[model samples]
Target: MTKVYLALAHQRQRWMNDLFQRGYKKKLKEEDLFELEERNTSSKLCDEFETNWKLVVKNAKQTGKRPSLLKAIQKTFGVRWCLYGLLALVKTIRLSQKSLTTTTTGEIINLGATDVLRFDFLPQYSQYILIGPIVSIVFVFLLWQVVGVSSLAGFLVIIIGFIGYSLTGPCFGKLRNKTALRTDKRVRMMNEIVSAMRVVKMYAWEKPYASLIEKMRSSEIDKLLQSSYFRALSISSSYVANKVTIFAVFVVYVSLGGRLVSSQVFAALTWINLMRFPTATIFGWGVEYLSESIVSIRRIETFLLLDEKEASILDDIKINTKRNSASIVFENFTAAWDDVNLAYVAENRDATQRKTLENINLQVNDKKLLAVIGPTGSGKSSFLNAILSELPAKTGGVKVRGRIAYVGQIPWVYSGSIKDNILFGEEYKPERFRAVVKACALTKDIQSLQEGEETLVGERGVTLSGGQKARVNLARAAYRENIDIVLLDDPLSAVDSNVANHLFHECVCRYMKNKVNAFYESFIMYG
Candidate 1:
């Protein structure tokens, strides 16, 4: 397998070199490159391991073996643990999305890129840590058969090496913990810099920010260098230990006034050499990986334990097709973005004074257009957030009986065509698409573009104007079928008076006339 892989790698490298010499080109076909069909694709390998792991987990249950360090070691002795760890990491990531308000992007990145990978590399040598001593004992017995009491000297040397690993393993883990934190800090700062690059450049703050990032990077590198030094020590010690153990056995045997036969000496030496891998090499790697894996698992555990979004908060919300029913009803409802305060308020209703949206009673019947007017930072968006179940409820309850769509205050767009953004993963319907485009006042903007709705918007819709992005966001929600209530979080704030008027008249009052709509604004508007 190694030889085949090496040959394939060389072939691909040569092909890549040729392609680079020809210059990079767009729309390159897969057939244009030299390729080999892989029998073991990642998906196939994962599926195979998953099938095996299910059986292993079932057997473990039958044996009544609960999760523990021993059980984990037994179960993780194979490559399947990599898949197990990855699946768990993915599930944790999904559950952690709501809690991301407190978690930094860099921390999440390290969890996926650095921490999850420790599981993959661990099983390769983990068993050696357990079997290292047992194998050493067996080798000691074998050597004693050929060299009698002299074998005790070799055993002593092995014991010392074991103790050395035990002492240093935790120190390596501590260094790794420090390194991982520095990595997260550096990555988080980089993400902030990338996101705010425009502002940084505008103020000519490039050098200062660059210096800050470099300082962080230097700290991270220093930790990594310390870890490298420790790893070098492990390798060098293992090599020296192997030589010293053999020498000690020979000197002790000769000191016993025993005449050494060539056959017995060579036989004893062979057994000691055989013990080298288990005692020195594999044991060293196992200890290193074990320490690193422990740190990784703890990091992942911390992330998994972060607060998840309270998706079940709106248990009173029910879908109803009846038009006579109220689309949304707020009965003495109070909500707050800070769940800590909400939890306190949960115990004592008097603490509801700190809530973002105080107890309020309101109802919007089906197809009604209700406008919520509030000043900046006066909880206009928080009101929408409460309905969306994003804010934790403090008092009373909110009941909804219809499917709702929301357009946030800040429009979101990914790297995709205008039409794709408008479709938003919904099936494309030509007539509905045309109507939504015209209703959201996006028809003119689309027509002015070279590719019309098919034009690529680039990342975050950078190529489009703010008004255009807002309309695109609105059109996305409007395109969805059977939406009973629509929440607009000051959508008109970015557009001109004319465009806002057009959106209000054509989109809200006319196109979405049958759906209950709520508009958030700083001041009341008759339109």
Candidate 2:
């Protein structure tokens, strides 16, 4: 633990000095480049790894060997090669998801529940399952035709086939439900842990919470094991069916020669082709690692390849005065998350998927204070996000002018020092930086620490209190001096009323002291 903390502390110090001297290698707001993200989570990452991560994700149109039909056939021919294939599949899925988020933001809406529930039919999974049975029947029927089997014998074969088919369905159905439910559960559980880490800390219930989550993770492993068992069973069942049919054909040929013109081995070969569809249909259909990765590939591919809306806003407008800020305009416009009238956007059609915000227009003047008020989920955050350029506005709908800085609610704090959170890989302006620290009432918070500004905050700034996190976020927004606009998304919502009042006063006094640019303004969307 000491070594871990020391290593983390050293990393923070290096980044602190680095940001001061060099800053981030690239700007985040730049439209042309994807921001570099260098972190990985172990729990939810693909277990079925793939070496060809870049190949699968980079150009989905050109399907390569990783987790494709071609590769699957190769692996089937030589199962030893499958170990390499499975490893490659994992990396492929992870990288694909990362690329998609990098390229697309607005358009990747969830599929309709009904459509998603038919996941079994998706080509990645369904083609194998459906083809296996169809091929099996076709092979058997063709063999029967060639041999000229009697009506009674053919009827008996069909009855046996039907009985054999019935045994597999119930197990396959359970596997399907288990695969889906478990994956969904893992995703949701992860969200809860990260988003609500504050609650766990405040309650001092980390151990219990972690234990419970680990238990859930263990359950997922168990589910996967169960799926593997059933898949093996499925393969075994196919062999059993083939052996029975082969034995029957041989006995008939031996007892009554000349009744069978071709050897039974030839017929077995036909039956082998027929088995393809069912083997693919039942077990491989639902919960195989390969099938899961394929499902991920589609979502990740669309995300990586989806066209991003070009940055059309004018960033070089000439200033009428030497002002740092500008006003914003929202024309007569309406926004809905889901429009019942929208035929093409058929998904999220449920009325229960309530509208985030309706048609309303408001103007925020330069160097002015505006408070947007509404209950939680009443589009308050939506309104703020629209102005901040995080949410998309219709062409000609949002006409925002001037430079802007933002402080988000529940703002992100990295796994570093309190000061690093404020710096955020930016070139430090010593005077302005110190001013921001004071403005946000963080000087005292820093003094309480052992190493002051250098104090390591650990992951998500877990070492700091909630109110302290808010302060660091506030300082980040307040760091710039010649700012045109500052948008605070409930900056003081977490602090005491008195502290909030003091912080707001400090912010105003600092702004008023500076030569106010015609564009300079501060806004409290949820003030």
Candidate 3:
């Protein structure tokens, strides 16, 4: 029985390896193998098969020598420590590259969130280009000694190759810059499409927006094609340079009346072949990487150097012993979304300096409901933003005595189950959960769902109605047990009058009335 099982496992491994090799060669899609019923085995077995197959593919790509030749070489040579060292170095490089790529990606995301524009993304990629050339030069020098090549000839070849490589830099830079522009345009288009998807559908602007996105994508593809052409030319040139150097060395040796013995000739050729992979990799991918890294570094530097919003003085304010009580006091405060530094930079300083809110004295005592009433463009929302320290305070400041919970004018929902959103990271309590759900009038909505509170809410609650989304948003705030203040930005606006009244009475009046609440309003409520 044991032998039979072992035989089966070996056969399965061989079959999977063959399948993977064919997939690598583009003979079949790897996904097709997964779809086969017979291939459905234990995950552990599958993982082992995959690991072995990857090793096989990697070895095949790195060396063109037959298995028999490799075995013979291994037998002739005890252990090639240089080859082992090279493999280890390559592994280290790959691990470092992965970590750097992840960190750089995170930095790019953070920089995008800031106000900085037109950041170059090339610098991260360009470092490899600088490092690769140095390694290649050292390896070539060592190769010259091993092959007993004339010093003068080797030096001439090195100088020629370096000059040829240097000439491609300007072309690569130009291509990279063009590619960067196209990439920026594509990103902008994608952001616009995502943000205005609802408006686009409502206004029947789908065709136009789609066309615009397609146009940008097409333009980006064109830029990529042009860049690829330059990249291909550089790679081909590097390969040709290697060939030329070998020919030149042979000619120089013969001209110098140097007897080229078979052993010497073969050794030189073999060493050259060994150098080909790293040399080609350095000149080809290294050029592209350098161009990209330079752009990335510049963009990151520009973003990092941008004048960020000054840290709020209130950040250092300690919470008082009155944890259950919350109060906010803004004394003759003047605030704006615009940067104060911009006023100094502008030609017409006074004209450019526009305050969103000016001389706004406001106070909301602990456990009191404060209503802020205003007409259109009356800076009602700005008042709330100022309290949150989102808008910069030009004169005076806001003092908040406790933690805050804010429900924005636009209801925000994350992708998760309803229960998860409400619970957030807090310890789940069934009683409090039930109470908040009922208070927010989400009981019926939860019951109607197939999975109840555990039902998955699609991205940004796309699956829920406007009123349902607003209620869930409200429930999340209401469910927080430790909230000392609640800032409601017309939460009732999305629901019907009946539901609004119910929510106001149950959720706001009964529950939140005891907590300090700042409610922004644009209309009168009969209730």
Candidate 4:
């Protein structure tokens, strides 16, 4: 009876080995199949998104409005499939415009470049933060099944390693903050140096500035290196933990007089190896990424919370689309540029301050022309700014009952055709275009140019001369159809006497006849 039972058991063992081999082979085949399937799935996702984005862009162009990424996605894909990364990006862009007035250019750049990218890492490895623990628990159960009570020793070592890795999260967060700040400083310094390179060369400040930038770069690199060291330790610890877990499990199993069969021993090692990745590698990386993301979120939150431009300040001025009686009225008005401190100053009433334009009492009823004459720092620009609602009111109110067309002191132009600059996004009318060109004295200039109205002016009108740029600026304001007030802030300063006279008489007097014109001239006031 004993011989018969032993023979039956041996037969069953052989059958089980054959079954396991077949299953393992099938798993390898399935892995290959799933890999290709995943690749195709990812490709399809990207292609679909590209098609939808193109449609959104086309619609935006036709309607002349900026496309919302969220709307585009919601239209094509269901709301349930919404990606938080895209949502966060859209929100950042919307809030960032408000931050522009308060935040530095470098800080804004870092938010886009570095802080936004931190979100990318979160979706990839962040799942491991939850999955790691659950998976580790399952692995421990499987390890116990194979190696019995000895598996506890290995799990204890793993738990210790996990706790150690988790503690480094705060350290990584601190390091990331320092690196980000240094990077912003470095970028800001670079921008300032590049912008003032000509002046820097004149003053021989190359070496000093270079040294300062190098010092900043060195500090940034040091923080990054420290972060890299932590990353290396994490990766190395994963390998060490795997080896140590196997060693401890075997040591305890042998000491407990458990006879290790080849199948059971290999199974135990395999489970430990699987546990190492989720427990150590992925968990460590996920924690670090989470820490970095937290820091980034706080930075972005602070930026988005900064004060925005006060559109309400401009609500006081009434808009009237009539030429019957154009006017501007300022009653006990005091204006200032530092709007952030305006409320505080108003509350205290004893702050020592130099007002931009103070205690101004003025009115222009049924006026054709009103000219303001002042010295360099005599609030000439401030007066126009107060009317524009750019300089916020500190004490009293300003009433502007007309649509204003302002030609600033420095003639500004963007990178576009001269005609585009003149039209300024208004519908092009051939007769009106010709008249504005003639009135602003730009007809001869355009005719002399190689491309006439199609000539592409470089950035800030670098390709055009100062007088030509000023004429282009004036033409922009002049080309408008229903402008009731024209504010000329030293517009004629760059032009010669002949051109200035032509612009004043032809454009301001005849072309803008019946309109209220405010001229800020240094020498004379024309009314």
Candidate 4 lDDT over 1-527, as tens digits, reads 99999999998788567557777887645544324454235455555654675586568659955444445445544532323333233323433222345566788788889987886677678778888888888998999999999999998998888798889988999999999999998998898888667689999999999999999999999999999999999899989989999999999999999998999988998899878888889999999988998788767655544433354544433435444566888999996554443112225344666677889999876547777887898889879877776666779978787778999998999999999999998999999999999999998999999999999998767699999999999999999876778899999999898888888889988888777888888875333
In terms of lDDT, the poorest run of 10 residues in model 3 is 85-94
Candidate 3 lDDT score at position 284: 55
Model 1: per-residue Cα lDDT over 1-527, one tens digit each: 99999999998788577666545755566766755345234565445444554464456548854222223333433454533433334334344223656568898898888887887767778778889999999999999999899999999999999989878888788998999999999999999999878789999999999999999999999999999998999989998998999899989989997688889878987998899899888898888888988888667645644555454553445425454454788899986655542101225344435678888899888879998888899988877876776665668877777778889889989899999999988999899999999999987888898899999999888898898899999998899887788999999889988888889899988999998899998874545
In model 2, how many backbone clashes occur?
32
TM-score of 4: 0.71
Question: Which ten residues in a row are the worst by lDDT in model 4?
Answer: 89-98
Residue 159 lDDT (model 1): 96
lDDT of each: 0.79, 0.54, 0.65, 0.79
Better of 1 and 3 by lDDT: 1
In terms of lDDT, the poorest run of 10 residues in model 1 is 340-349
Q: Where is model 2 poorest over a 10-residue stretch in terms of lDDT?
A: 106-115
Q: After superposition, how far is residue 32 of candidate 2 from its true place, in Å?
A: 28
**lDDT: which is higher, 2 or 4?**
4
Clash count, candidate 1: 0
Question: Any idea what lDDT model 2 has?
Answer: 0.54
TM-score per model over all chains: 0.79, 0.55, 0.64, 0.71
User: Candidate 1: misplaced stretches above 4 Å?
Assistant: 1-87, 92-98, 310-326, 340-354, 427-431, 524-527
> Please, what are the lDDT tens digits per residue for candidate 2 over residues 209-292?
778778877876787788678667656655665556556665665566644445545764565445544543343443343344
